[model samples]
Structure formats: C-alpha cells, structure tokens
Target: MSLNRRQFTKLMVGGMASSLLPSSVLAQGTTKNNIKAIAFDGFPIFDPRPIFGLSNTLFPQQGKQLAQLWFSKIFGYTWLRTAGNHYKNFYAVIEDALIFSAESLKINLSPNDKRMLMEAWLNLKVWPDVKAALLQFKKNNIRLAFLSNFTEEMLRRNAKNSGIDDMFEFYLSTDKVQAYKPSPLAYQMGVDAFGLPKENIAFTAFAGWDAIGAKWFGYPTVWVNRLGKPIEKMGIAPDSTGKNLNQLVDFVLT
Candidate 1:
C-alpha cells in the first residue's frame, strides 16, 4: 500500500498542528530559560550493522535474517502489523517479525544467538556528523544527554561508539521509566531529571512522531530531517527542521 502524493500531503498536513503548534501557544507557555540539555535516538543516527554483524556469527542463518529485517524495518520498508505503534524501537517492533519470518522459513534462533545479538548492540557506530555537532553544543554551554529506549548497558556502549559520552550529562533509558516515548511519563522523567521545565529544553530527534510528543509536552522541538522528507502526520510542525546536526546547532545557537 503505497501512499500517493495526495495521501502523503494529507498525512503531512493533518499532523502539522501536533508537529508544529502555533507559536502563540508556545510563547504563552514559554519561559526565558535557554535549552538546558539535549536527547537523541542512538541507533537511527548511527550505522547499526556492526552491532548486528556479530549477530551473524552466533545464529548464522537466523542472525543474518534478523539483521536484515531490522534494517529494512527501520529504513522505511513495509512490514506486517507491529505490536507497538510509533513508540516502539525499530528493533523491538521487529523482534516479532524476525521470529515469524524465521519460523516460516523453519529457522530457530538459539539462546546463544540472542546473547550474541545483544552483544552486537553495544558496538554501534555514530554517524559522522554526531561528534562535531555535540561538540558545538557543548561549546555553547548547553548540557547534552541521551534519552533512549535502550537499556543502560546498550546506552553506554552507544555513548562509547559515538565518542560523545563526555558530552552527555546523563544517559537515560526507558527501563528506568518503564515506558517509551509518546508516553508523557518518559518525556516528563527526562525534564524532571534535568530539573528544567519543558519550555526550557529543546528535544531533538529524527523521528517526527517523537517530536510531536515532545511538542505536546511543551518542549521546543527540532527535527533533524537528515533526509529531505515532509514532516510526519503529527498534527504539528517542529519549531524548526534541519538537514543535519550542524543545521540543528545553527537553529539552536542562533
């Protein structure tokens, strides 16, 4: 089911309000505080194959299949209904698909296969743009952090991989909150942890749905498009949109 141009435009417009709320509302609720910190999705910004590369050695057949499935799922290929909606991680949503795809092919992933995949997760590579962008933010005195759905160990490894671990004042995972994004609790916990109000923080993400959630929570939002796609159907436009982290820095620092 491919969306035609009309359908795509409708999707983008219908969700524009949620993605980009009126500036009046934002101003009414806005405080004078500068952005205190930043949060990002680790895997989407970085290449994830190396982590999954190790998955191949343990499961051999199954591992290779799951790795490919994960990539296809995240990179905009169509798949069957996933359990969670936009809030689920690319990997979690595909776990079921991977299992089903494997079973249909009569492949069974052993426990060791799973463990090895988990190990692969710790070694994700940061996108080339990430380090320079974070350094720019740090130079401007904005606190930086990661708020992700990954577990503590996974987040740490991602930090090491990105080489921006030192820039992050805190590394938050969904395990600590027991919920995912679009859940006010998750975003709230992020705001509370930094002891800042929503208006004071700028939530940066490539995910349009996540940006919508952050906007609904009253944070100034920036969408890093990376690709020049229309904003998702989130009923609001981001406060600003950018092609990369450097663009985001320009938006924020300006």
Candidate 2:
C-alpha cells in the first residue's frame, strides 16, 4: 500500500522510536541518490542561543536588537564581499558585522564586551541530539564534514568544546574559495572534499536559504527547520525537510 507524505513521516518516526522501521517505509519517499557523505551547515550542529543570550546579558535593553543586527550583518558582509571580489575570512566578517551592528544600534560596545561575544562562538554547545545522531552516522561509516561559512578555527574550537572533534572528516570553510554560501564555489567544496558525485553527498542545512543553495548546487538536500520557518519563495525546494538532526538522520540513513 502506498502512503502519503504525512503518513510516511509518521511511520518513519514511529519506526525510529521502536528501533525498527519497515523496509517499505525506509525506501519510500527517500531520494534515489545513494548518499555516501553528509555535509552539514554549522547551525544544525552548533546551538547559537548561548551567544545571543550572552549578548542580551551584556547589553540588557539592546541585547536582542544587537543580536538581530549582528546576525543579519554577518551574512550581508559575506555576500557583499563575495560579490564585490573583496574577500576576507569568515572570522573577520563576523567581527566587522559586530562592530557595524553596535554602531548602527548606537550601543557603545566595549573591548571586553567584544572579546566576550566573539569568544562565545568558540565555546558553542552542540544541540542536544547531535551526539547520538553523529554517532549513528559514524557507526554506519558515512563520511561526515562541516560545510560552513565559519572559519576552520571556529569550527574546530566548538567541535572540541562539544567533544565531537573526531566526528568529521573535513572542516570546509568558504574562506578556501573566498566566497560564501549560495555561491557555487562554496558548495563545490563538499563535492571536492568527498570526491563523489554531487548526488551522493547529502547537504544538511540549518536554514532555508542554505537548503536552497545546496539544492541549486546539485546535491540532494535536507533542511533541518529547527525554527519552523516557512519555505522560501525560491523556485527550488529541498529533497526533504525535518525538525531536527534525528529527522535528518532518518532522511539520510533510511
């Protein structure tokens, strides 16, 4: 019997709970491409809330405003730099964004405040389910790597802090290509690192735009929609969408 998408998702989740899913459920609705490696966007693996919370604590009244502006500027600076052929590393872009954000918000950011906020990225904690899902991927011998706009130092520090440093095979940074996501060169890093067809590397994205970027780059893509945001109006959609890493595992493994 054929199952609709919602029914199929229910069955898959139930099977996961019981530690056994029907083969039909596993095979149904999954991508035809044989995914050999999984490349993850940074946000899906590292929780950024603590950094934002710290911003709030430091600024009190302006914390949320500062966080919002800083976050927006992070991507804005990267894209503008990439488009203008002006390349700085992701860490530099982030620091620039923070300064811009503080200035825009008219918040006097102290040197100590800047140091504390920047250090937060290095000290990020992984999402609660990340360890178990990563363990399963390792057990299955699936190659895993971080395909992110974060600098390699940022990725390494957080992974080591979270005790998952050994989980990944590649620490791909857009700095290598001197570009940012949705940039074809940035996405190509995953294909180059895995030495596999784009179809065989599943790109797991934490944001809708990243999912669209990976899809545009020809990988089978999964969007881990932790924020429950609506799909973008982009012409393409992801191969799958899930609420968290466990659901991402279901899409890739099952």
lDDT of the candidates, in the order given: 0.66, 0.90
Off by over 4 Å in 2: 1-33
Model 1: how far residue 8 lies from native, Å: 58
> Taking the tens digit of each residue's C-alpha lDDT, what string does model 2 give over 1-254?
98999999998897776567554435433535567789999999999999889999999999999998999899988889989999899888889999999999999999999999999888999999999999988876678999999999999999999899999999999989988998999999999999989988999999898999899999999999998999999889999999898887887777
lDDT of 1 by residue, 1-254 (tens): 99999999999897786568764345333424366567666543566657566757656766676666655554332123222333444346445545554565566667675555645666677778887888776766677767765666677777777666677888777656656666676678668778877776788776677778778878788887765677778578788887778766766665
**lDDT accuracy of residue 243 in candidate 2:** 87
Best by lDDT: 2
Candidate 1, superposed: residue stretches over 4 Å from native? 1-33, 49-97, 104-116, 227-229
- lDDT: worst 10-residue window of model 2: 22-31
Using Cα atoms with residue i matched to residue i, what is each candidate's TM-score against the true structure?
0.67, 0.87
